[model samples]
Target: MLDSGAVAEPFEREWFMRHPMRVAHDLVGAMLVVDRNGDQVVARIVEVEAYGGMEDLASHATMYRVGRETIGSAPGVLYMQRSYGLHTMTNIVAHE
Candidate 1:
């Protein structure tokens, strides 16, 4: 899950600290897996949030200490953190 073409986002650790509104609706193509007793559940990601990586201080991207240009260049990065025993997540859009 951390490899493949999908590398870990420098922002991966930040999204969890932000406020969450509605994620389940946005996560369509993204994989959603859960263990219910002995059963496993999974789904795709469809929707997500925007973490202005270069500008947002509370972003995992900020932790990298990369130059503004480098940070801004990153795209398709995803961040997820579980809170209160709940999962919180978001993504970074590609720069066009």
Candidate 2:
């Protein structure tokens, strides 16, 4: 766990522009800090799923219109997905 005063340096826009697999590697075992309203939440990264783009059959880009737009857009696009018939996971689009 991070100390209450721990400060994280935000990554540059170029960082997310890399291929999704590389980003996934960088995310493993890293720290993620999120601040919403007045609450701050910190979590450790374990796993990630990467999508390359239209060529990636499993990517949203090949499934729907919005998928093409969002997945092809900049790196920080957010979308929703129902995983394993269990829960909906919020997804952030990252691609080169």
lDDT of all predictions: 0.46, 0.74
Residue 81 in model 1: shift from native, Å?
A: 10
lDDT of 2 at 7: 69
- TM-score of each predicted structure versus truth: 0.29, 0.73
lDDT, model 1: 0.46
Candidate 1, 1-96: lDDT as tens digits: 423476322234333343233232334455645569999655455665444555677655566433343445444443444444576644433443
TM-score, cand. 2: 0.73
In angstroms, how far off is 55's CA in candidate 2?
1.4
Per-residue lDDT of model 2, residues 1-96, tens digit only: 567696678766678877789887887876766789989787776777787788989976697776777776677665776665798655666777
Best by lDDT: 2
- Clashes within 3 Å, all models in order: 11, 0
Positional deviation of residue 19's Cα in model 1 after best superposition, in angstroms = 19
